[model samples]
Target: MKKLLTMFFTFLKIGAFTFGGGYAMIPLIEVEVVNKQHWIDKEEFLDIIVISQTFPGALAVNSSIFIGYKIGGVVGALLALAGVVVPSFFIIIIIAYFFLQFRNNLIVDLVFKGISSAVPMLILVAVISLSKSLKKELSTVLMILLTVIAISVLDIHPVLIIILSGIYGAVFLRKKVN
Candidate 1:
């Protein structure tokens, strides 16, 4: 009961302040879940991030659900999901109302631009943190490098890269269970 409540509130706070979506939430989630609460270790958090990205829907929502389930079962998952989504829904509604009112304000426009500029940095922070948490292995490093190149240079869709990476791992990188 207490654990479920903790999960709910923790994700609630995360969902409230985090902007620019899942990548922006990573650092905050890391601080709260790993550093403050010690709910999971750094490596485990990164692993969960990877799994969330490779799986489905929005990463932040998926992460909240995964952690919630890990801690407190189905009820926990529901509570945490509600916590994450409710804030965004209410905030978006409120903002939509105000946006129409202030759509022409120069200051509001400038503030939104400033926030847009910060998004890339937030994503870079998440990438660096996740990479640091990963084991320094040849194959892992090579895969990361290739992924970076593919996204940056080739402009490949991330979903395609993810799918192909999985297929490559299964076919070429799979090891015998002997």
Candidate 2:
């Protein structure tokens, strides 16, 4: 019961403090879940991130659920999910209620503009952090380059890329069971 509460509050803090989307929350999640709490190791967290990206829901939510389940089963998953979502739900509702009145206000506009500029930097930090953890093997590097090219030059859909990558990993990158 105590562990479940702790998970809920930790995720609630993560969800409330993170300004941008799931990508922006990656570093914060790493710090709390991997570094500080020791709920999971670094490699496991990276795996969670990858799996979260492949799923349909938001990355943060998926990560929360995965970690929660790992820690405290189904009940923990529900608590963590609620913790992450509830804050955003209330905040969005409040913002929507007042946004119309504040839309043209100079202070509100300036605040939003500042947030817009910062979001990109936050995303870049996440990308760099994740990249650093990636394997430096030739095949891994090639796959990374190919994925970037496919997305940027060929304009491939990310979902298709993820699916193809999964198939490729299963076929060519599987580890031998000793």
Candidate 3:
């Protein structure tokens, strides 16, 4: 019970404080779950991030659920899921109620603009952090380069890229089970 409450509150803090969306919350989730709380190790956290992205729902919610299930069980998953979603639910409702009044306010516009500028940097930090876990091999470098090109230059859909990458890994990058 205590652990469940702790998980709920921790995720609540994460959801409440994160200004941008799931990508921007990656660093905070990593820090809290891996570094601060020791709920999971770094590699496991990265795995959660990858799995979360592969799913349909929000990254933060998926991550929280995965982490919670790993730590406790189904009950933990529910608690963590609620924790992460509750803040966003209330915040969105409040914003919806108030945004009409502030729609034309210059200060509101400036604030959103400032947030937009920071969101990219937050995502970059997540990318850099995740990249640090990759092996410094030629295949790794090539995969990274190709993935970037597929997304930016070829304008390939990311879901398709992920599916193709998984197939590529299974076919060519499989490790022998000893």
Go through the candidates in order and give the clash count of each.
0, 0, 0
Q: What is the TM-score of candidate 3?
A: 0.96
Better of 2 and 3 by lDDT: 3
Name model 1 segments beyond 4 Å from true. Answer: 176-178
Q: Could you tell which candidate, 2 or 3, scores higher by TM-score? A: 3
Which candidate, 1 or 3, has the higher TM-score?
A: 3
- Cα lDDT, model 1, residue 34: 90
TM-score of each: 0.91, 0.95, 0.96
The count of residue-pair clashes in candidate 3 stands at 0
Q: Candidate 2, residues 111-146: lDDT per residue as tens digits?
A: 989998998898898888888888888988999899
Which 10-residue window in model 1 sums to the lowest lDDT? 169-178
Considering only N, C-alpha and C atoms within 3 Å, which residue pairs clash in candidate 3?
A: none
> What lDDT would each prediction earn against the true structure?
0.88, 0.92, 0.93
What local lDDT does model 1 show for residue 33? 86
- lDDT-superior candidate, 1 or 2: 2
